[model samples]
Target: MLEGIRVLACGARDAVRLCATLLERAGAAVERTASDSADYDVILVSSDFDDANVVARWKTSGSHMVCDITATGPQDSRAGRRWSDAQIQAMSGLMDTTGFAHGAPVRIGVPLTEISAALYAAAAIAAAVRVKRMRGIVQNIDVTLSGCAASALTTFLPAAFARRAVGRLGNRHPACAPWNAYRTRDGWILICTGTEEQWRKLKQEARVPQLDDARFASLAERVRHVDELDALVESWTTTLTTDDCTRICESIGVAAGPIVGVRDLADEPNFRMRHAQAARAMKAHGVDADTYRDVSIFETSALSDALPVAKRAVPCERGANAAPLAGVKVIEIGQYTTAPLVGKHLAALGAQVVKIEPPGGEAARAWSPGQGGTSYFFALNNTDKETIALDLKQESARAYLRTLLKDADVLVENLRPGALAKLGFTREALGAINPRLVYCSISGFGMTSAYPSRPAFDTVIQAMGGLMDLTRADGAPVKIGASGADILGGQAALFAILARLAAREENAGAFIEISMQDVAAWCALFAAGNNSARGQALACLDGHIWMEREVSDAERAQCSALPKAVAAVKLAGATPVMRVDELLQDGDFLADVLSAARDANGAFWPVLKAPYRLTKTPACVRAAPGAPQAVRLAPPAPARAPVPEDRPA
Candidate 1:
């Protein structure tokens, strides 16, 4: 969305490279040096560059947007110090929750701290650009890897204030039963049953007599004896192939997929289909992987110029509502974290999002970690959004969905790729109803790909996208502690929506597509920050450590526990290594960090500060889910309206 903009960047090689590439792909002209330009658009200076003269010059260049990529921002107590991804991840408390609880807390195989910082930086710059053209505003954005890493764990931060501790989860979910990997004849498969019907279906389809017992009859009971439950499920799953088990479970309504490894993901029929398509597309464009190693992984389609217009033509979703997205109205028709998170973020920014659910509510509502039958996951993602229950099996439910979309400014969905088009919500139908709507679809693969109809989940993407092999010291690759692929994919969807919104005045109707596999591959670049990082456990003075290294050994120095080793390598640098709980034990640290206090129920909880902020139109959280009410949405405008014109720049 940044066409005609000039980006002058000075930073570490990796950070600067990614930033410059994104800017370039976004149609921004990027220059490596800080040469003065009459219309200098953005200046990104890294913490690695401490040259006072260069920074001062860039600051005075009349740039519309300036961002400082640091380990910790200037507001932080630890600002002004250089950082590797390790130190930031550790202090952020993200690394503390990585790996199994039995194993020492390990660093994420990806350089998420840095990657998130870059992406946040990109998003912040994009938002600032839109503001500048709209109102002639200038923004100084300071993004920190430590801050980004901390924000990525916002879903878990409530534990801090609830007087609860967030610990390493390993692979098993604390709240959900039958939500782990099981041994199969050839390999392992992941089987998750979120509802009573699915569990019963598993018992009936697989003919597992053990599940007929009273102790395993209920979701709560199964969770109480998850180990035994796993054993019972595995007893039957072990006799089948990963494909056979997944097929059977899926046939019976259970969400099941294989625990894919790097090889399996690459060789999987669907992945190969997409890969072949990518290769052909790249060849057609004359872009060779041999030419662009780091940048090649981004889908060829995603790298295309997103927003072609130079000026901000659309009106900013702002006014007395006091939220950046105040006038925005979104209708989300999908389940799981990927699609709902996009709406959740929009709702947080003050959009009236009407979430469509089935008669039984969305699948996540029953996924456990509930209080009095209310799903915490659902509450976190669906808060402040109106809910409309519809059973699509009935034509009336589909008709009502069209009513909700009549005036929706945006439509976000992740419904198994092509299923939406087939379910009477075709593009032509939506276009006829709301021609100005910005449609976004989050899928496991692209709509045109051969495997678009296949079922995909976070673990499968992690395995196929090469995170598993890159995540550990041992050859066995593992999925991230959190759903990295899902959230990043969701964030990608959100980012694209924001871009389309910026240009909505010109092309109000746009279709943005996101693939979880593509996002996973993009996140894998995090490991590029530390080629030597094996995700192995290391001993620290008071705790364990995981380090993200500098690419080549000759330049960047490494840390070591031994003083002699320090003398050899100049070692004792502040990398984020210690366990998060151990670090939180210090009362002084708790008092100092930037946090948001939420009064949920009768008690207050703490969540980390948002990674980025908008000075004029800030992100706002209105309320939490209270009592579930049945409400009908107001009918949308039947006639298509003209795109709104820009008010100011």
Candidate 2:
């Protein structure tokens, strides 16, 4: 999709390498050296790069799309502290929300914050290119690891508002019962039952009559007695091998998968399938990874060219303070986090999004820790949009959806590979309805995947994507504390959509298929080549602090003599590890990252702001789930003649 585009990646070795890998995967011609002195379309620089003269020259050019990837947000850059995934994860609350209830906070295996910042950088660059094409606006983008990490806290931040401490639940979910990893004869298997029907199926599959107890009947009741529920479920699981457990769960239509280790990830059918497709994609561009060591992983630095400022073909439809996506209209058919998150971001940037939910609402509505009949979990992703409930099984609802699509600019969905098609809204059908539509689908696998019907919860993807293995604690695999697969995949989908939007031709539609597994593999590129390190946690007088590099016994002893903050301040090359609760007291973090948003119940809560900063057309959160009066979309235009088949991007 980025064919013929040139990108310069120069900065920290690891960061630049990752940026180059991603740009190359997108078909861009990437140059890894800053000394090339060649004009480029985009330049990505890391904060670690200290060449002041080079930075000054690039900034003055005003012709290239420059993106700076930093450890802190624009407001907090003055602190100038170096960071690693573990420290950022600690400060962002992701680490504190993970691990065993009684144990210390654990780090995510991968460099999550850096990876997230990179994705945002890539998306922002794509957005800038689109703006330049549409209105001749050139913008510099600033992406921060802290900003991205705060964004992922959407699912956990609401609890802080309620004065509830959201501690680590380990493999157990905070919301539902039978939603944890259980031990089997050979290894471990994860079982997740979200609905009542799925819970019944799990019981039947396990032949566990004890699950029929009244205390474990309702969702709330099961959660209240989750410990007993887990004990009962594990009894059945322990009798069988991991494979036996998985087979029975799948056979009964329960969401379950074996907890995969690193050595076994490459052998998984789904991972192998995704790797094969990636190889072919890269090979078409004359780039190929010789082995597993090659598959890899965004960001911005210099502006150089002066494309003539062009007049928009269409009249401006937004106010003077319009956001980046001010006039775009989007239709979102999403459940849970992946596609809904894309919609949330698009809405935050001022797109007019209408979310289509089932008549009974999406499954996420029932997730725990909610307020006034609304799930806080659901509110996090469904913000800044209007919603319509439809029973797609009914022709009338489908007919309404068809009409809604007639004037839509983008359609985002994360349903199973063929679920939408089965309802008669295939890519071809969507293209026929709106030749200008950007149809994007985020799925566990591509539409042509070998395992179309396999269940793909976040747990399953982490296990199969080699994340669990890399995030092991004491040699035992564990999923990342946060929904890494879903968030990363959603961000990737957004990037593809923005790229397609920028390269759009009149009456030309594009189909974007993003596989969660593929995104996981791509993000793991750097981490896959390096040995997994969970980071060192040093004991302090009052609490603990995290450091990515190994700390000797003497260093630990020195730090242990002081409080966490004092230790961080006194110890050379140390910073305080923060928790989600600490965000409430962080002035700088609160200023740029957190915003107050009212939920459907009129209760005010904290939510994350946009993850990137665009100088000209910045992203803003104008409204949330409960707010009314979003950007009023234009009335449906008269249907136009259908165009040729839309091609996939």
Candidate 3:
């Protein structure tokens, strides 16, 4: 949030623009100028490592957060390296975990690493803000794109950590079978049968007799014989149109949705609701609807409340547990991937998060790779959180939450636009009740956008923002393997939390909004902005080979620099075009992966480790989250106590 903070943005790269844009969107005042770094609360200098010493001093003086974004971390041998997104992806070993199992190992369509690094840098800046305010210590945040990209390889952690071999699962997630897109009579439809009950429902629709075979009764068996299982599913999917598939699946209580393009969002209930609301407003004004700009950006609120700095100075140290965010307290109400992941990230960092869910639990709990009605991903993403069943539609529940927010540092939610406001949780409303609260709202388009009411599902954001178009190299647009749009939005929300939390002092708190669609568009800033900056489109040539080595000024000046870099890597006999699945087959790559692993109680474990480790306050996943504990909340009293943060960290 850094609402009153000013940021000095220096550089002309997509990363710089993205960094500044994110800060500005989160309420920071940003100025594009290389002058007077002393005047700003944060300074972002691009491609100029020479200022490292000056930046380091600025941090030490407890002045501003100086962030350096580059291709590699300061500890890496390739510090000060310059690279394109394709180059970074090709060499990071992460690309080996993406794309088709047998096809070319392609990069995620957008500048994933750069944007992800920008996000990391932004969060670091926010974290620095918190550190500076809470402890009078200025922390320098250095982020490398390659490192942030690798940190996001959490989906690969389950197998990577267990000393088991793992590879690309393609469109099918490793956690669940039938959790992929299937062809229909008209187009494709995404569906999942994560639990036995969901499978039974589909069986009811198919009328397929003998599906109760012992071999397919359990999840392990279904995954082991996924090929055969999918064949049976195709038999039904191939017979129905996309709409029919969705309708039938919903009718039978299965998780399913039509695979639609971006333009289709306008017709969805979410966006159509916006249209209807706008029409009504126009009618009220007695004006022609066509004569007005869409008044879809709903009005939100903000406030400042003075919270006495309690004497409880929770040690801001890494502690023996290695949790950087040991004392952070977060309360969130989320249903799916985007918002849940944000809470999950904080939880992983040792924050005590309380998730408010419906009595039936969140929909994600039933997503695939589920057992006894709970999803594996839901379990993992919700790790380190406490869950409370609350019917928010009830006034009693609202009162309970208001009491909880009294001392909680952050509150995150992803309900439909205006859902919270309708529930009497507007920015102004919440701020009046608990001024030190940093409220974060993550949605599909935004809290207030032209299409404020439109659905912001991962697929919709991908399709509408053109991520699908950029991903397909030689065919029509198709979704990337990962739920990138959701992931990006989650990351954005996490970044916002850091800044907003930091901004919360004795008297002020901030309101932050993140749009999934906006984050999706950031992925293409490089491809779209390159031409305007250089008067030529960026060309990756083969789009395969990449160099991980540092590029000197002399080499960078050459018109043949890219080719030369490619040649250097090829000379080393590297397999530049290997698919992600192929990497597991390489003895050398396998060994390298093993070398990075740590031994815990005689078992080898590979962490989803971040690139730049904090020297004194590293982040760690200390323990697996179990069933959440419940708390009894009532009307607030004047005495403020910390959110119940009882955890291992």
Candidate 4:
């Protein structure tokens, strides 16, 4: 219980707010200060500001723990000596944003590690205060975002190096095969056969005795002839749907599953369970607080108890009063899923989102599975948003965009790496137009990369970033069915935009940039950690096989004879016989009988007994008169040029 402790927070507006909130939660008296004071037990400084007056003033103080929340590296006294504990912690905030950028040094999204570092800094200060009370000597602690991010690089940097210079492989592990995604009749399924036993079981279950033949008999031989195996597997899978293939493979003992899409995952039981936990944690973080907040830390010991404590009450309504961007307007200058999704979320939260498309409108407008003349693109990402058409390459359109930016609170774009500057809307130009505007730039790679000029798609990034490598279960790499990198990048952009908006309250002209490549690398790092611990390489798609051994001829004949008996019973319109005790018995006689029928005539038929009833209906549906007509939506208009008057101040 921090009963005797006090905290002095100094830094950027948000950092100060966060420090103060954390201190208050720990039961410390929090005071906002521009300069360090003698009475405080801890001084937390946020380092966005360039002014040195505060540091100069704090240097004279002794016997206090210091923490810095800055993106700048660890601080050193002007004399080139290390500062006290309190002084070091104050600069932790600035160090969080240090990283590689495409054109300029860019900050990461969410500053997650930075926030964690700040909390650790607080804990260190508290420990130091205890020591000073006992030994009468104050200590200093330094936490930098850069250092924290570097420490967080447990797997990311290594994986990145492995991909570029170390010779990256897609979904295949050099050692394992038959462990990748394969196309089925309707979709794809991920098949994993990591062991010889599992592989044999898979072949036995698929009823393919040829897999056990000498030439393709051993795992080594299978690896040597993976292409042939994959071709055969694909040919068989072409006759079955994804569900059918997965069921047949899994029943025998192969590790296999259908490749699920994002929407499909959202509805899955496991995803729902995880999401519920995450939602609960978010709520407990006091997200509804008008100011900053802290989340509760969970301990393993507490979780291991028979009866775990309930989570804290969730924060109250966050956006109940009004929109967070109530007076703000946004102009979305992006296409496809990644860039446009940012505007979509903001629009859902009540921002006035205006989607600007080119003369032909966004390519997504013509994407398939349209309803009422509305593409899934317009319906999904463009919901609650307005659409306008404009050709930015034309002087008139460019002039209009400048006008629109005049009143806009945020301008978001995801053009090719250099397209924005070529269009004369450089960061300087836009900042000049609206000093308070938050300009968010999204690109495939950061501006500082050698390949900054190169274009990238989700698949390419997935391959290059090591996602395809780690996703391989046996030896072949396979792409995740969904465009995970693109979607996560969009979420990252939204998160960065929100933080910048908060920062803009004080710093007014903050620029936010996000790279899809970085996002992919981060995700890959997480996957690689799992792979490294298992000491296995990625799975490959080319060596997958799904087969099963044939049943004995005697058994097969007996199984094949049951279908005729069942059919005769059905044709006679006779009530199938069944004892009540037989019905109560816990055996799969019905399934066996059905299988026998399928074996006999290549179709399943069941003879219903007294307890069961069946009904049939025509497939066609008749429409009633005066039925409501399906409404056909018109094509979205091209994006309009920004009106100069709307530029941000």
**239-318 in candidate 2: lDDT tens per residue?**
99998888888777777877765445555566666565545543454322333334432111011112222222321344
Give me the candidate number with maximum lDDT.
Answer: 2
**Which segments of candidate 4 are over 4 A away from where they belong?**
1-320, 530-649
Given candidate 1, what's the lDDT at residue 569? 35
Comparing 1 and 2 on lDDT, the stronger one: 2
Superposed Cα deviation of residue 334, candidate 2 (Å) = 1.0
Tens-digit lDDT track for model 4 on 131-180?
A: 34433455455544433322222112222222322122232333456755
Instruction: Estimate, for each residue in 548-631, the C-alpha lDDT of model 1 and write its tens digit.
Output: 432234322222343322322343342435444444564424543443333245432233344655555555554454434454
Winner by TM-score between candidate 4 and candidate 3? 3
lDDT of each: 0.62, 0.72, 0.60, 0.46
Candidate with better lDDT, 1 vs 3 = 1
Q: Could you tell which candidate, 1 or 4, scores higher by lDDT?
A: 1
Candidate 1 TM-score versus the reference: 0.77
> Model 3: per-residue lDDT, tens digit, 1-649?
4787788887544566677777776678999865653478777765543465665566576566666677765555555655655555665555656555545454566677767777766766776566555555544556667666554544554443334554555456565665656778987676766677877778778765545677677888778777777777877889998877777876766656655443343344433354465335434553331212232122123543334323223335543444556677889989767778788777766678899988667766665444445554565566557788887787778888888887787788988889988999877687767666668888877875665434445655665554665665235345555567777788888886765565544435566777776565445434333422111111234334433344444533432335534644534422254333443454533432222322222332233344333333444444333444455655545667779978897
How far out, in Å, is residue 503 in model 3? Answer: 3.4
lDDT comparing candidate 2 with the true structure: 0.72
Please say which candidate is ahead in TM-score: 2 or 4.
2
Cα error, candidate 4, residue 557 (Å): 20
RMSD of 1: 9.6
Reference-based TM-score of each model: 0.77, 0.86, 0.65, 0.38
